[model samples]
Target chain A: MKSDIILAGVGGQGILSIATALGEAALADNLLIKQAETHGMSQRGGAVYSHMRISDRPISSDLIPGGAADLILSVEPMESLRYLPYLSETGYLVTNITPFVNIPNYPDIEKVMEEIRKLPRFIAIDADAIAKEVGSSRASNMVMLGAASPFIDIEFSKIEAGIRTIFGRKGEEVVNLNLEALRRGRQFAEENR
Target chain B: MQKHLFLGVEAIGQGAIDGGMSGVYSYPGTPSTEITEFIQENPLAEERNIHRTWTANEKTALETALGMSYAGKRAMSCMKHVGLNVAADVFVNAAMTGVNGGLIVTVADDPSMHSSQNEQDSRFYGKFAMVPVLEPSSQQEAYDMARDGFALSEQTKVPVMLRITTRLAHSRAGVARKEVLPENQLSLPADPRQFILLPAIARRKYKGLLESQNLFLKLSEESIYNRYEEGAEKSLGIIACGIAYNYLMEHYPNGTCPYPVVKISQYPLPENYINRLDQECDEILVLEEGAPMVEEMLKGFFAKGTPIKGRLDGTLPRDGELNPDLIAKALGKQMFSGYAIPEVVANRPPALCMGCGHQDAYVAMNEVLADYSKGRVFSDIGCYTLGALPPYETIFSCVDMGASITMAKGAADAGLIPAVAMIGDSTFAHSGITGLLDAVNEKSSITVVISDNESISMTGGQDSSAFGKIESICIGLGVDPAHIHTIVPLKKNHEEMVRLFREEFAYNGVSVIIPRRECIQRASSRKRNKK
Candidate 1:
């Protein structure tokens, strides 16, 4: 009845879009949802996060308490590790393997992957490569959502519908590319599992 | 019956619309920016011909809303906590003048200094002005408070302060909308001189304001927003205000807290509920988003009454925002198994965009300023503030909106030759022009770089009030035309920009440099929209 998710990534990386897709999916299921997003200065290519709490009952807090998040779905690998404290012991973490190398001192990629791999319940995928293969590089976030989709409580079909609903304005071609990206990501997660 | 998923800011806009607001005025600032943006974008608002426009500054926005209210139309003015300081003169005086139509002055406070200069609470402002402050716990309450805030304003004939912090303002939830109320018809105040606070008349009005406190308190006690809920335990009474109530409620998911609780949204501090909680409980913890206003008041100078716990007593953090984890810690609940953050993650402080004009301008300034002492460059708010970080840490101080120009003037007067101030176009329009005038009059040896991005790029590209008028405004303010130089911030123009900077730095009197370029984000978005 309740799913507390932490969406993490660098700003302008479509993390909010992922939150919105999941939120719309939750709404489609008649679930109450509260998504607390970072706005203002943080949006200018800074490390950002959004706390999403969905429930059958009225959600009390906009934030997910530390160590209570059921899922930490991130679009960037380093950003994923940034919120490890919020992840429940039994929670799942699905993060894109690619590093958003904005900072001069970004950690070694292998080390970042090593830290993520240490977690029991985690899936690290090359979302960027998969998204490019799916015919749109911008759908990397969709690939991330697809990878996190199974761990999330919402139905895959519902999430797909949510994507279509969100991307419908951009034209059918864009929608299809994102759909393909999502399916590939879901397939990768399923195969690995 | 209609429910729409809305951010807390959007909910306020929706509530204002449903509450029959005729005008919504504001100057764009973080957290508070989206409220006016939402109203401007609403189709219903357009149909109603609502007066929704970005003002020159928060003061103008407040005054414009007051003017609309004077015409007997419900009006709302919104701004961030700092913006309230800009509009404080009008806000304090408006309390004395009272209202003809309803007026709601909504302010969004950013705790933890997120996108703000300071985290000063606006509840203090409401308390100082002796006006009722309404803080909503949820998006629903945010909607309801904004909808009903008008009636509260009209009934009391005083502007209501609908105060919300950044979390509530930016947080998203489903808001169930109410039936639309009709806007008030145009009518004047009963007394012609009601707004005129002449010395003799001001004393009478001040007395009326002071006397109105009892009525405000009575209303607060009677308000549904302020509730005293009985519970089985008396070990620890909880006093949660606004969004803090939501954090408290998170602990007791079944809609019940074990301790006696006072959920405060409407303030004058419903004394009846406080008295009951004081009598019933052993210890009381006050959980408010901002300052420990109520906690301090209850635990006075003598430190009398129940052991009050909150920010002051290390029960919660004295600074920054309140979170569920902090709330749980206060309640002696289970703690999170704190995972050590990897040292690998470098701090990703916000920076100028890759193609941002500010980047090029900063690059040029840094190169030019190498000949001079560092820390002489003063900056103001906007995306340009990012220049304080990496590659080009050129700016020394960014105190407030207009402090840069004036501070540069002061430093120049103190013999910091060729003192420089870097401000954005919107910020220049906000408060920099006056300082520029003062520099002109004093003939201060300062170089003012008005980085014209042609938009208020910091708060998500709201229309810049100084869009195309920065040059004219500078000239009109008495700066010599020849001294006002313009340059495009680009790689090819880097040499020219540096040359201009060097020339201005050597100028004896006031010299204005405008680095002109549309914000890349705005430019791209505008292009996409056109396509």
Candidate 2:
């Protein structure tokens, strides 16, 4: 029952928050979760990622093997391609269309997106556009997460409940916005899928 | 409890909360930054009235935590391994000036130079300081030991160090929650003479430290961490540590590992375990990260170790880190060669992100220094130092934090004047101030380029110490207002910035050119959010 899920993205992208939400959702669904986060150079436009593993059974390991992830939640398209190796054979890939291509040597967006589309399982979404229309682009990651929720082992309400308390601790305003983000993402997924 | 999940960093912070910490003081450094960030963000911290704030750098962090400890409170200071070097002065001495309160210094070591100039072992600092060190095997242990670390310090009359490698620092495990305890009420030191570290007082304190060895050895024997795991009847005996212990078990997943292993995660190395291992197997592999300190010590204690294999024998790479395959080879097991990562063309590695102020600072330094027949730029530790690598290559020296200014002073005094001292905003506050004071008093003609990125960019965008004060610090240090010029470090303003650098290069006294700009990477993410 010891399995692994690796989530990676740049900082300021709410990648860590999305991972937190996922971890919470898994826990709420009655799973044992162990997530490790490593982000430095994240301040320096460096890539940030976390290794999350949830098991219905007791687990001993924290890290996942290459290509072992059951789901790849890509906040941005390039990140999806970058983390393609971690995807299991039957894994689902939920990605947004925004490109944060800061690295000069990296291939163009079209090339990277083309590479991601070539992968076995990928679901690309304009999560950023959805977030933009909602006037809060920071929720782009949550949008992608909501779009991917039905595919994960856990139900969406558990994720919503997790998000409620998480943002509830801050204020009622953030809770409302985050809930709206979830709804918009779910709606996007229902319509598109 | 609804089975709350946690990030490894947040878990450490949560562990601290569960372990009962009074306060956390730190300067953000990668890998270790989240420990403090989590504390600041967690609602429990606010509800429980916990304290969390970013200090100037590691020195201030150590000193502030020491101040809290002085008040008889449980305090922790965290930073990357390199930050230990900055805190070394106070850190080494804190052992002699034992505390009424408990102090735990957490250092996250970077292996393979991830966001660090070098991968220095923090355990070496523990040895140098003669302080007790604890390494946790998993996230749960990270919490347990973190709590124990404080009491252990109190028991030994010295501060304790929690040394973790990148793997352990970044890895997570199911950490069962321990009962949270109440915070230790702030109390004062009993004896006023306890902290008077003058030579007159230090001699006895040093003697006191030596006298405490018995206590250290006692803890080493009974530490909950050090374990003698029984292995299958066969091949060899292995002495594993931290993540290495995890891998040892992983390699022998079927529980048929053909070796008797003594996995240790605590300091001073239990003598009983060593004697038992000595009687047990044909060969011994001292598996550890960072240094061969254990191998060197084991050789001194146990005779020849039945042909011990590690860094000394070159069975493993003397430098860098050890992984499962490397451990397998050391155990003479078949190695799993990884998938071939194709090499790319010899292009310059990433220097600074576009619109980054550090880049403009470098560009200005290079442009102005080209005017001089001889140009020497002494660089300190920060994101700005990345200029030493790529298209910019402006800085020459990168030793420790604040090393740039002092190193520049030395070179300037020895006929290398107009020496450019390039340093970061956070670094200037950390160690740069003392060097700046040195430069001013000595009248060292060094042109100091304070690359004010408004955040500690290299260490993952923690608040920069100079967020409010940099000009006044220089002004108070006797740099004239005329000499202290500022410029916004965008690409379009490079020409004007170069003009400023040229002017500073000609100044007779210590001149500061503050190229002020928010870190592009930092601004991009947080700018949208209302603080």
Please report the candidate that would top TM-score against the real structure. 1
Q: In model 1, which residue pairs have backbone atoms overlapping below 3 Å?
A: none
Q: Tens digits of per-residue lDDT for model 1 on B1-531?
A: 657899999999999999999999999999899999999999999999999989999999999999999999999999999999999999999999999899999999999988998999999999999999999999999999999999999999999999999999989999999999999999998999899999999999999999999999999999999999989999889999999999999989899888999999999999999999989998999999999898888997887778899999998999999999999999999876646678877789888888999999999999989998788999998888888887888998988889999999999999999899999999999999899989999999999999999998989888988888888999899999999999899999999999999998999999999999999999998998899
Weakest 10 consecutive residues of candidate 1 chain B by summed lDDT: B336-345
All candidates' lDDT scores?
0.92, 0.76
Chain B TM-score in each of the candidates: 0.99, 0.93
Which numbered prediction scores highest in lDDT against the true structure? 1
For all predictions in the order shown, the interface RMSD in Å is: 1.0, 4.7
TM-score of each: 0.99, 0.85
Q: Lowest summed lDDT over 10 consecutive residues: which window, candidate 2 chain A?
A: A58-67
Candidate no. 1 TM-score: 0.99
Candidate 1 residue B91 Cα shift, in angstroms, is: 0.4
